[model samples]
Target: MPETLRKTFAKWHHWIGVFCASLLAIFCLTGGLCTIGPAFDHWVSPLPPSISKVFHTPSAESVAVATEYMEQTRGEAPAFLRLPTPQDPVFRLIRYDGNAFQTILSLHPETGLPFKDKPSLETGFFIALHSTLYLNRKVIDFIGLFVSLAGLGAVISGILIHWKRLKSDFQLLRLFSPTPRRALDFHLFCTLIALPFLLTALVTGVWIESQHLVEDFSPRPVISVTETESQKNLPAHLPPEAYKELYQAGAHYWGKDNQGFFLIAPHQALLVPSDGKSISLTRPHLALTQIGVKSWNIAPSTDKNISLTAFVKGLHLMRWATGEMRWVVSLSAVLLWAALGAGSFLLLMKQRSALNRRNACPSRSDKIAFSFAESFALSAFGLLPLTLLGLLWLEWLSPKIPLSLSIHAPQGRVDAFFCVWIGLSLIGLAFSLFRWVGSFPFADKALRLLWKITLKGSVFFALALPFITLLGREWRHLPLLPNTASLLLEGHFVLFGLILFMCIRKNT
Candidate 1:
């Protein structure tokens, strides 16, 4: 409350905000992508239309055939099999290292052989990036610690700095005002709007990451095996079709109302089932829904219900939330993204103005910093979205490209992503930042021309994505609802492109 202390908090807020702004933006951007979409990212997986066209009920024989194939060929034993469900309609052989799953293969319901065992655009890639940023556990834990602490600190300091204005500016907007006032108001409004979601996400994220850190460093406790030696050493042959068999038996008795999934482990296959009413996947956990286990050696597990860990994980990830809850979680992240973007823009503008004022003094470091910021702004604003659509375009086109084009089939889509991204980064930097900083009298004419072309051309390209995606043969298996969702997402992108088009200030 004191003026001096408030000023100190204000300074802390500004500097910390500066430090976290870009990374927070990136965090939100990737998080938003990971959570949302009318069309789920997993739908674009590399399943062949031939295999995907029809649903075939999986039988014991089918599982046996698939199991035989996997046991003979796989380097590691397949941990579990997923039965034919309406959603997937094929057997999935899954293996796990720790808590992480590696889907070994999808087997044909009829032939029981592996289908196209790879997906080009893996949805898991984004999730992995969000969690670990590809760093090892210990390293990422440290980063997570820093992010959480700094985020909390930023929020607290921001509250201190804007304690009075928070309430006063809650409903204020200068949308029709001059650019400077309008931009500031927009930034403030977004900050106020997004504060609750941002704080919740940070807190939840910190809790989840901290648990991992503690678990990683903590020593394991010793366990006493009280089971009879003969029972413990019981030689059990795990039928590859065990889950399918059990599920069939359960379904026969419980009827269509009960549904669930199996969790495959080295020694036991746990059946986590749910009745539609009392317990559904919307909030079901291992303890909550785990009815029993099909063990290789030990007796079937007794019924268990509910887990605190599962609840926390579900709440943070929104994996347990169904319907409108998912929308709230996703939209909140998006709003946070917009707020971060507005705040970052304001910071960059302030820095640029400061740099311009110091132009007479000739600060090389300031120029360099400003140049980096300028280039980042251009890439994030312009090239990022274009590259995303380019990825879609390339994915659709890659199947049409003959093998002679030298895009390796396995890595082709990934290659396309980087090619578009890096290519645009290079071209954009040359035309925009490098030229603007140079003494050339042409005065970045190349940038203006390039910008105009991109903005105008991209709207048409975005509008065409739904049709192109629909035309993909692999997508023929999509149900009517999923197809509709994909189209709705495409329309969203079209609107985004139109917004870009409207940003043109003058002719090149």
Candidate 2:
């Protein structure tokens, strides 16, 4: 390839990659946390002793409470309610008028009253941010469309820039390479490691997001074409007494032990298999029943497109991934973030060296590149790590932070996360801009100190967390087995942590 073409590829990779870096960092961070966040959140959160008593309540009665509460409090009936079961005993009202993340409420099964307001846990907020970005479903789906496309461009440009080294340096990690080149090598290595995962995610992510963005994936469309004749004919509305009878029938047929695994809607009640038993998010395990129905009407989506789409979703979301494999998926996300960070760092260092050489009168592109580099630097070194440390501590410290003060707590610590990222990024950016303008001798030292402290603190905390949690009360809270999976997961964490520790060591 000509030198001009190679420089073009590098420019595309650096600029486009920087723009997506911070956003993808948020995605990966939240995705990784969501896997273990719920478990850790529950482990750290404490229930009020007064309201802590838990016991089984009939599914019908629980749904009855949720519906009544929804009607009385919100002046709108709940579209569906999750009935209480042994594993999760709270009555949850969700999906109102075919909309989610609206009017979600938890109620005591026996009393049908709201639980005391407290710090949000269970990682549902993080899950919501991951899938929907806390925006309207349609908006997020559309945003994902462009993000996936841009991701493809970034990937292609990256490949173009590294084609020469693809074979020879695929597994190469020159720890002692020149400072700027070493970061570049690590970035390339991480890119190679994460390529398969990234491609799979981009393709399937685009497909799934397009379904919702254009077709508007909703309950009506979900069932309209794919549902069976019997299912399409199933009545939606059921009387209160009929609901009770239906519950009794389900209990009898599916075993009393598995009762209440149902989502009650006015149109047709969906009784899904327990979450652990279900792999595909939108396929086979779903069953529909009407008021007088005694048999399960399993959804037979015979359409090949529907089946293929379900499999695609399973791939994109990794719903079928289990045990340490789920950790691998999460780790893939983190590695991709690390690659972006390394590339950002390499660019920043290169740009800084160039700026020092010229000392003044940089081009417009150089200025823009510096701004982007600085933003990515702040995001990579400061915002993400601080937010991670704060959230990590929150996981174990929630039970310790007395909730005696209420009504002001940010929902899910989202306010805290946002504030930290925004504030830290601005401060870091200000320092970089000031240094650029003033060309102060001490500015580099200040920036280096900030970088070292944040990176070291974040990495060390990550290294200590698992070991400490294992030895502490949080260990009892893990929804994991005392088996090889845990060992394998910790091993993966240590491996990644050590790699990061080395990167920090080299940079510092």
Q: Model 2 off-target regions past 4 Å?
A: 35-120, 136-142, 175-178, 215-261, 265-268, 274-281, 285-311, 407-412, 439-446, 467-496
lDDT of each: 0.56, 0.62
Q: Clash number for every model?
A: 3, 2
How well does model 1 score by local distance difference test?
0.56
Off by over 4 Å in 1: 1-7, 36-38, 42-118, 159-163, 166-182, 185-196, 218-237, 248-268, 272-310, 358-384, 404-412, 415-464, 470-482, 495-508
Question: What digit string (tens of lDDT, one per residue) describes model 1 on residues 57-139?
Answer: 56556656776654443333436555555445566665544323345567886777787744344344456546775568888
Q: What TM-score number comes out for model 1?
A: 0.70
Best candidate (score: TM-score): 2
Report the Cα RMSD per candidate.
6.2, 6.5
Q: Write the per-residue lDDT of candidate 2 for residues 245-348, one digit (tens) a residue.
A: 55565565555445434455434555544333344444333444543455344442244444667778867776555444666777777788778777777877
